[model samples]
Target: MNALYNCISKYYPITSEAWKALSNALTQIKIPRNSFLVKEGTVCNNLYFLERGCLRGYYSLDGKEITYWFGFEDNFVTSFYSFISRKPAVENIQALEDSTLWSISYEALHLLFDAHHDLERLVRIINEQYYIRLEERFMAMQFKTAKERYEQLIENSPHILHRISLGQTASYLGISQETLSRIRSQV
Candidate 1:
């Protein structure tokens, strides 16, 4: 909970009263490893703030899985489009490790927006940050070589190299595991 408060505080000032309201609104949940936070074809109505552990978002294509994103502690994990659009999710957000998360329902968040002006501002800022991250990822996928992408991934989240499986890391980098091994050897 303190982690969540600190994360929010980094972006927006919160009044004590608002903080209390938010604390009361967020529900803590434990997710076992290999559990799905958001499954494909399910509407995602909650946004999760990870307090501990790791998760990955991926989708299957022609029976092959493609990893889209990986997130660890202090990260916000969600199917943002599905949550915002109220549509079925295209990807699955799965816990890679036993995890603890603070979750707020979409309805609860909107209610908070009306009650806390600062929270509303905070959400807007968060959206902008999410967009920028998405854009960077897009550029990396479109313009960067697989090795470059792997390097960028290391720079962005070095812990992922140790925490995730080689196959999963290769999928994330859009390369074969053998290629990943080759690239790793070169490094």
Candidate 2:
């Protein structure tokens, strides 16, 4: 896929054999809207790279879905804890639209990492980036006011409001649907 090739090319110019090997390890999967890639309590077997459409990672609390992050085209989506430790995932990854993605199994990823040091470095970089995003989100939730968070959310992801429902967006911002509506009224 072009997305996969682009990500690989960002790290290095892969040899023809390397490209072939990488391609061999990946598979294209189409997910219907509201379908799940990783469900709660299941080990996440693959790292998904979104090619088209959108997805969200959320956890249920008090019968509520609280979204922590969204993934769209060109983003890598996965439950790292379940994928890395081979344990049950605490979160769910769901498609918000008809989605296309390229996925590689954890075992296949490690095999490729072992086979190529550069790929290992690339993986490390991606891991660090993901961690930083999580840290930033944690900080934002702790330090920013709900209205401020709402503003930052739009600034960071201007297209998200158009893509998902307000209730979900409210959940992502850790606010109730009514509160989100009030905030929207001001904007």
Candidate 3:
């Protein structure tokens, strides 16, 4: 739970009292590699904050997984659409590695937010951060070529190419695996 406290502390210091109040509300979740945290068509019930692990969010189309983003330790993971709207998700959130996370259901989070002003602000700030990240990805996809995107990916997270499968990496870059291979060879 140190990670939880530290992560929250970055945005705002959590008092001992606040921590005590939240501790019992958080549930520990163990996610296995290659399985889902949130599946398509299911409403996301929990807001997961990864303590130790990596995860990817993807959409499936024509029987293929098209990953758009990845998240690592000390990061929050969820399907925003499903979470905010209480509707079924169109994306899938899956662990890339075996991970342990701390999670609270939306209902529990709302209750806490209502009770704690700081927590409400923290969630809003975190939401804004996610929105900025999404905007960056969208702009990259809109303006960059496949090779350029692959280059940017390599520049950003060189290990990502090594850690995930070729298909998965290609999908995340919005390119075919063959194109990914070509870009990779040049690098």
Q: Compare the candidates by TM-score and give the number of the best one.
A: 1
Better model by lDDT: candidate 1 vs candidate 2: 1
Q: What is the Cα-based lDDT of residue 143 in candidate 1? A: 100
Q: Write the residue-wise lDDT of candidate 3 on 30-143 in tens digits.
A: 989988899999999989889998899999999888899898889988999899999999999989999999999999999988887778888898899999989999999999
RMSD after Cα superposition, model 3:
1.2
On the 0 to 100 scale, the lDDT of residue 75 in model 3 is 93
Best by lDDT: 1
| 58-128 per-residue lDDT for model 1 (tens digits) | 99899988998998988787899999999999999999999999999999999999999988888889889
Question: What TM-score would you give candidate 2 relative to the actual structure?
Answer: 0.95
- Looking at model 1, the pairs that clash are none
Off by over 4 Å in 2: 11-16
Pitting candidate 1 against candidate 3, the one with the higher TM-score is 1
| Residue pairs with backbone overlap in model 2 | none
In model 3, residue pairs whose N, Cα or C atoms come closer than 3 Å (at least 3 residues apart or on different chains), thus clashing, are none
- The C-alpha lDDT values of all candidates are 0.92, 0.90, 0.88
Which portions of model 1 show Cα errors greater than 4 Å? none
Instruction: Please tell me which model should have the higher TM-score, number 1 or number 2.
Output: 1
Query: All candidates' TM-scores?
Result: 0.97, 0.95, 0.95
Shift of residue 37 alpha carbon in model 2, Å: 0.6
